[model samples]
Target: MKRSGNPSARDTKEGLVGWVEAKRKPIGTRPLRIKNTSRRRRDMINRKSSLGVALAIYLAFCALPGIAAEPDVNSLPKERQQQWDKIKSGMEQEYNVCIEHCGGKSECEQKCRQAHESRLQREFLKLQTAEAVPAANDTDLVHWRKTSGTGEQE
Candidate 1:
C-alpha cells in the first residue's frame, strides 16, 4: 500500500506529538484572516477621521459668531440706527450727570457709572422685548420703563 504525505495521516501514525506539530504554523508566518480584518480596521479608521473632520468644521462654524467683530451700527437700517443713537445719547446724558454730581470723588463717580450702566441695560432689554413682542401691552413695557425713571407708560 502507498502512504499519503497528508499531515492527518502522519498524525494517526505519530500520535499526539505529530498532531500538535501539524497544527502549529511556521515562524514568521501570519494567518490569512489578518489581511481582511486589517483592511476593515483601516476603513473604519478612515470613516472615523472623516467624521472627526466634519465635526471640527461644524464646531468652527458655530464658534464664528463669538469670534467675529462687533456689528457696525452705521450699516443698520434708519429706525435701528435711531434707536442706537437714542441709547448713546442717553448714556452721554448719564455720564454728564455723573460727572457733575460726583465732582472729584472717584468712588461716587464709579457708583453713578454703575447705576447708569444698569439703567442702560434695562433700557436695552425694554427695547428688545418691546420690538420682539409687538403685541406686548403697555403695562409690560411700563414695568421696564418704571425702573428706568421714566414714569410715562406710553
Candidate 2:
C-alpha cells in the first residue's frame, strides 16, 4: 500500500485526551445549574424576602397620617364664623321641627319647607343691608334700606 507523509503522533494523542476530559465533566456542574439542595434553599430564601418586602410596604402605607387631619374652623374670620354658626343653628332648629311635623303628617312638609326658605331669605336680606350700610348713622342706614327694598320689589 502507498503511504502518505507521516502525521505527528503526539498531537493526535493530546487532542484525544482533551476530548475525553471535556466529556467526563457533569453537565449540571455548570454555573447556571445549581445542585438539588442548593436550588431548594435559594427558592425558600427568595420567597421569604419577597413576602417580607410586601409586608413592610403594606405597614408603611397604613402608618401614614392621610386620614387623621381635622379641619380648622377657627381659621375663618370671626364675623363670618359667627354668621355661619347662626345660620347653621337656625337650619338645625328648622330641620328638627320639620322632622317632627313630617313624622306626624307628611302632607305638611312642603308648607314647612316654604316657610323655612322665606325666613332664611329675609335673614339673608337683613345681613346684606347691614353689610351695605357704611356706618351706623341714620342717613346711610335709611338710604341702604330704601335701596334694598326697591331692589327686592323689582
Candidate 3:
C-alpha cells in the first residue's frame, strides 16, 4: 500500500521483502553475536602484557651500561682537563664573537662551534703524541739530519 507523502515512507510489498532480505544473514554465515565481556577482558590483558614486555625490553637495554654516555671532564688527567677547559672556554668566546659578527645567526654559531671542536681535537692529538714520545735528544736530531741528507749539522 502506497502512502501519498514520501515515496520512502510508502510500505510496498517490494520494500517489505527488501527489509527482510537486509535483516537476513547470507547462507552458511552465522549471525554476529555481541562480543563477550570475557573476550574484551582478554584483549585488555593482552594489551597490558605487550606494554609490559616493551617496557622490560627498554629497561634491559638501558641498564646494560654506558649507552650514549659522554666522557666526564673531571675524570680526565689534570693537563688534559686544563686543555679541555681552555678549548671549551675558547669555543664560548668564539661563539660569542661569531654571533656578534653574524647578527646572532645560528649558522655562524654552528660554524664557530665546529671550528673550535676541530682545533680541540687537533690539540688533543698533539698532546697524545707528545705523551707517547719521550723527550727527543739533540743527538737523535743530528742523526736524522745526517741520514736525511740535510746539509745543516748540529
Candidate 4:
C-alpha cells in the first residue's frame, strides 16, 4: 500500500516490486564481521610507540650538534636537480620572451609577467584535467602569442 496523499509514492504492485528489486542486494554477498576489539589497547600501544620514536630522535639530535633540524632544498638528488633545471629553463624562457616584448618598460614588463603567469597556470589547469601539454616544438613566444578563436575565454 502507498503512503496516504503522497503523489510520488509507489502505488501499483509493479511499482512496489520495482522498489523492492532496487533495494535488494545480491545473494551470498554478506559483509565481513572482523573482530575489531581492543581499540583502546591498540591506541595506547600506538601512542607509546610514537613517544618512544620521538624520544629516540631527540636523543640522537642532542648527541649531534652539527646535524640540521630540517632538510635543505639544495641537497636534493642530482636527478631531481636536473628535473628542476628543466622546469626553471621553461619558465625562464617564457619570462625572457615577456621581457623582450616589454622592451625595458617597467609597466609593460609587469603586465607581461601577469599575462605569462596566468597563461602558465591555465596550461597547468588544462593538464590537470588530463589534457596533453602544448607541442614541445612550439616556442613559448609562438604559443603564448596565439590568439584564441573566441574573443574571450569562458
Rank list by TM-score: 1, 3, 2, 4
lDDT of each: 0.65, 0.59, 0.62, 0.58
Tens digit of per-residue lDDT, candidate 2, span 1-154? 2223333222353353222324545664433333665877867776787799899999888865443332244755577558856985787698778868687675687677656666765655455445533455555666675676654211
Q: Pick the candidate with the highest TM-score.
A: 1
lDDT of 4 by residue, 1-154 (tens): 6665564566675555334434655554533223564767666766787799899999998966533222233655565556545654687798999899778999999887766666555444443443233454655434443553333322
The residue-by-residue lDDT of candidate 1 on 53-123, one tens digit each, is 89999999998665443335665557767897788697879788888988779899888876776676566
lDDT of 3 by residue, 103-131 (tens): 76778777876666566666555655543
Per-prediction TM-score, please? Answer: 0.35, 0.31, 0.33, 0.27
Give stretches of model 1 more than 4 Å off. 1-78, 132-154
Report RMSD (Å) for each prediction in the order shown. 17.3, 20.9, 12.2, 20.5
Model 4's number of clashes is 0
